[model samples]
Target chain A: GESVGLHLPTLSVQEGDNSIINCAYSNSASDYFIWYKQESGKGPQFIIDIRSNMDKRQGQRVTVLLNKTVKHLSLQIAATQPGDSAVYFCAEKDAGNMLTFGGGTRLMVKP
Target chain B: DAGITQSPRYKITETGRQVTLMCHQTWSHSYMFWYRQDLGHGLRLIYYSAAADITDKGEVPDGYVVSRSKTENFPLTLESATRSQTSVYFCASAVKETQYFGPGTRLLVL
Candidate 1:
């Protein structure tokens, strides 16, 4: 079975610093990857996504890097702020359009 | 009101009881999904509907049933709820490649 997993359960970063969250996936056939952010009680929000053909995709303050060789995915936040505190999840979509989600990493932005 | 919405944001029911969680999406998207989120498990798909009257089971479909009578609504029913079924349930609607989730419904079975 294919699985998506996070390397860290919790990551604490000081304000105005760069925060990186890593994810590893087992399905090499996965072509589409997405990054989601979930607040304390809100639903997961789309952050950024990268296709297997693209090595990196950038959003406003976030960048998603995908390494198909190692089946590794990462989300990088520049100038992390308190508002960026949330649980980040990485998901991979297969050919059937089914998405496998990771356990999620809790990001705490300390002031 | 424009995006996906789930009813009974919080529910508490006992074992052997039947409970239904309603999901409504105004976008008229063809893809709708139900998922459960637990402490250790991030989010496991329960069921999904591609269109009206077109439904399929997902990763964790046991003890759950779903119906799609209309394109805008997808409801998940627990015929006989169990303690293990207690978790935060989320409803999502997808476009081409992006999925938008609703504020989940927290269910607790005692």
Candidate 2:
């Protein structure tokens, strides 16, 4: 069994500011991690991902950092905009199984 | 109209009634998953299919059943709906590592 938890359930950032959302997982066997953003009335959309062997991966204005040693994963969003206000989730993929997502953190960008 | 699409964007049902949520993808991905999101929390996988006719249970599969007869379609069924089953159900498809999700189906069980 694996448990993924978010350090912050909610985060607020001013427009143009950067936002960081953190996630902690309990599975040491997990080899893949991903970050997803879910807007209101929409499903989670892939943001970025990092493999166990890699520590970081960047996509657009988002960067995902994977700390396998600490079982920690974080998603950093640069130049936060009002459109970036959404819920972010970090998921861990075990071996070849489906992903298990964390509780999720709500990111709010104030204009 | 492309990628993934969920049917009946919103649904309402009574307890003990049976309801089915449909999910379809045009990506022809190898994996299709069903997940339920409650409140503002993260999604909990309900079931997933690795390929046609090959399915497996996920984190929360109780009272929920799923079937994937084709590579593009995965349907979730709640034999007897309960209030606790009310949530937004999302269907996703993955080819390799990354997954893509459909809009989602909002289900309410009275």
Candidate 3:
């Protein structure tokens, strides 16, 4: 079965430093990819997304990079903060509009 | 305005009992999705509806049933609940690229 996976289950970063979370997907047919941040006791929130055609897309303080050649995806957060700590998940949507999600990476910010 | 709301934020039921999770959205989005989140499995889609009266099975839909009689409502029903069905279920709606998620319903089957 095709699945999306992350390299690390948990990542700890300094509050002022930058953070990067990596994900790998198996299905090449997936054309759209999105990054979501899920806070405790809340639902997942959309952060940013990147299409298969583009390599990267930037948001306010977050950026999503998609490497189609390796079926890799990454989320970069600049100037990480305590509130930014949460479970991050990468999702891929094929042409059918069906989305497959990764296991999720827990981001912990150290003060 | 409430973007999306799920009823019975938490539920507990015994095996063989039936349970239904309600999802409602006010955005009038064309697409609605139901996903279950477990420890090992992050989020697996159970079902989705592209529009009213148009629903399709997703990755994990064997023990679940869904119906979208109206565009604003998409409910998931477990005819005979099992212990394995215990998990956090989230309802989401997508306009085009971005998806908005509801708070989620926590179900515990014993």
Candidate 4:
């Protein structure tokens, strides 16, 4: 069975530093990928998304990098803040709009 | 404007009891999905509907049923609840590009 998985289950980073979270997907047929930030007690919020046709996409303070060759995806956050702490998940949309999500990574920011 | 909403933001029911979670969207999106979120399992799809009266099972669909008689409403029902069924359930709608998620309903079975 194809699955999307993350390399780190939890990450602790200091404020003002950059944080990088990695994810690996098993399905090559997946054409679209998205990154979501889930706050405590809330649903996942869309951060940014990148298509397989592109290698990278950047948003306000976040960036998503897709390495299709290695079947890898990564999310980068700049100048991490306390409010930036939350569980992050990566989702892949195949032929259908049904999204398969990866086990989230808990991002903890240290003051 | 109510983009997407779920009824009974929080629910507590007993085992063997039946509970239903309601989802409503105003976007008239063509795709709607139900997902469960738990520790270690980020978000597993339980069921999804491509259009009215068109439904299909997802990764985890056992012990659950869904009906989409209208494009704006997609409700998930638990025939007989169990402890293993306790988790936060989310309802989402996709407008062809990206999926928009509702707040979610937290269910607890004792």
The residue-by-residue lDDT of candidate 2 on B33-79, one tens digit each, is 99888865568888989999999998889999888889999999999
> lDDT values of the candidates?
0.94, 0.90, 0.93, 0.94
Tens-digit lDDT track of model 1 for B1-110: 66999999999999999999999999999999999999987899999988899999998999999999999999999999999999999999987667899999999999
- Model 1 is docked with a DockQ of 0.84
Query: Which one wins on TM-score?
Result: 1
**Model with the higher lDDT, candidate 2 or 3:** 3
Ranking of all candidate structures by their TM-score, best first? 1, 4, 3, 2
lDDT of 4 at A37: 92
TM-score of each: 0.98, 0.95, 0.96, 0.96
* Chain A superposition TM-score, candidate 3: 0.98
Instruction: Itemize residue pairs with steric clashes in candidate 3.
Output: none
What is model 4's DockQ versus the real complex? 0.73
Best of the two (1, 4) by DockQ: 1
Share of reference contacts found in each model? 0.77, 0.73, 0.73, 0.60
DockQ of each: 0.84, 0.70, 0.79, 0.73
Best by DockQ: 1
Determine which window of 10 residues in candidate 3 chain B has minimal summed lDDT: B37-46
Could you list the CA RMSD of all candidates, in the order they appear? 0.9, 1.4, 1.2, 1.2
lDDT of 1 at B104: 93
Relative to the true structure, candidate 1 reaches a TM of 0.98
